[model samples]
Target: MLQHQDHLALRLALIANKRATVVRLRDERRIDDTVLRRLQATLDSEEVRLSGGAAVE
Candidate 1:
């Protein structure tokens, strides 16, 4: 159970990091709005999936 929690935490952290990175890239104009939106949606799905089909925010 603890290990599962640890893995979940790690995955959440990674998703968060990816989100921040994506936003940063968008702000820097390295990624276009369409790509940003698509990636963000994908990340959102991943986060919700990790949270057992519920969104965190």
Candidate 2:
């Protein structure tokens, strides 16, 4: 399991990725729930692996 600090770090990493993706995609002026959900799911999977299956609130 990931320590609390590690979990926090993972969350921060995911947030950074999301923000970067948003900025990169913003010029398209198009976004959908499916896209956002996919991004979130990808992050969640990473977090689960990084945290040893335990997710932080």
Q: Which has the greatest TM-score?
A: 1
Error of 1 at 47 (Å): 0.6
* lDDT per residue (tens digit) for residues 2-57 in model 2: 68888778676877688568656654657666676777677667667766787555
Per-model C-alpha lDDT, please?
A: 0.96, 0.69
Q: How close is candidate 1 to the true structure, as a TM-score?
A: 0.94
Candidate 2: worst-modelled 10 consecutive residues by lDDT: 22-31
* Backbone clash numbers for all candidates listed: 0, 0
TM-score of each prediction:
0.94, 0.51
The ten-residue window of minimal lDDT in model 1 covers 48-57
Top candidate when judged by lDDT against the true structure: 1
Deviation from native of the Cα of residue 34 in model 2, angstroms = 0.8
